[model samples]
Target: MSDHKQNPLSREMKTHAMILGSFVAIFWVTELLDMSIFRGRLDRFGIIPHSLVGLRGILFAPFLHGNLAHLIGNTIPFVVLGWLVMLQETSDFWIVTFLTMIIGGFGVWFFGAPGSVHIGASILIFGYLGFLLLRGYFQRNFASICLSVIVGVLYGGLVFGVLPGRPGISWQGHLFGFLGGVVAAKLITNEKRFYS
Candidate 1:
């Protein structure tokens, strides 16, 4: 009889995979519901600059998308980058995600153009990008540096999204989400150093 004991790292990876999968599922499900039952009206839940009512969008915006194409655009990068963020420590995923949501969402609310509503998972996607790109520099460790290099090589082009070039894209979301990721990396690395 062959034994089938799973290793700790394998278990951790599975857990991380499930978490990422569930989030992606939610994104798809929400979009489906909005398109079919809600008639795209759910998009109004997205951040509206300078409106107290819009403050709630910070919590809902990431789950809402402008369209099927928009959601599809965000799904792949979200899975890839999100997996990378979890590789070092699964908890880092939660921390980075939380920080990015709060910081990125608030940035949109405060500085976004008036009369515009921002919605999509791109904010979180950009946050993951920022974290991975800078985690190496902040941690200053061999493994982290290697991971950062790999990520930069693969996703460096995404940095241009932060600039104000696209007509309908939310550059503010990208910029602030990225900054939020940088902040998350700094805080996490600092905490590790302090503890170690």
Candidate 2:
């Protein structure tokens, strides 16, 4: 009985896992439906640069991928970096996600090449990377600093994705998503400072 006593850390980890798992499941299910029934038509919902109708893609784009390979490429990083963001505070995950979607989507819509449709979870993945990289500096704490170091060593190579050279890749999305993550880390740390 005592062994089963509520453990806040354990409960929190479970909650984080459930949330992340649900998001990954949604991504997979949406892709399956898009490929099987929609015949990839749903991809039209992805961000179309400078089109009014495309504005809606800000909310939908992350869930839409070009193919299995694209989704598979995004899955591991999304899970790993997303879990890192949740370690400090679960609510931070939602805040960072919301900001990244809005900022990164708009950046692509405004600056991406004409007729291009930006889709995939890479935007959010970059956002997570940026947030993890900067959270330590903003928070100025030992644990956050250590976490930042670990993340930097692990994903430092991904920083190059923000550059505009990769064919068919949305570098604009990566840049803006990274910016959004920086903004989120700053905002969250400031809020904590104010509250404390």
**C-alpha lDDT of residue 28 in model 2:** 99
Cα lDDT tens digits for candidate 1, 100-145: 9899999999999998999999999999999999999999999999
Cα lDDT of model 1 overall? Answer: 0.94
Give lDDT tens digits, candidate 2, residues 136-164: 99999999999999999999899999998
Question: For residue 56, what is the lDDT in candidate 2?
Answer: 88
lDDT (CA) for every model shown?
A: 0.94, 0.94
After superposition, candidate 1 runs with Cα above 4 Å error: 1-5
Worst 10 residues of 1 by lDDT: 1-10
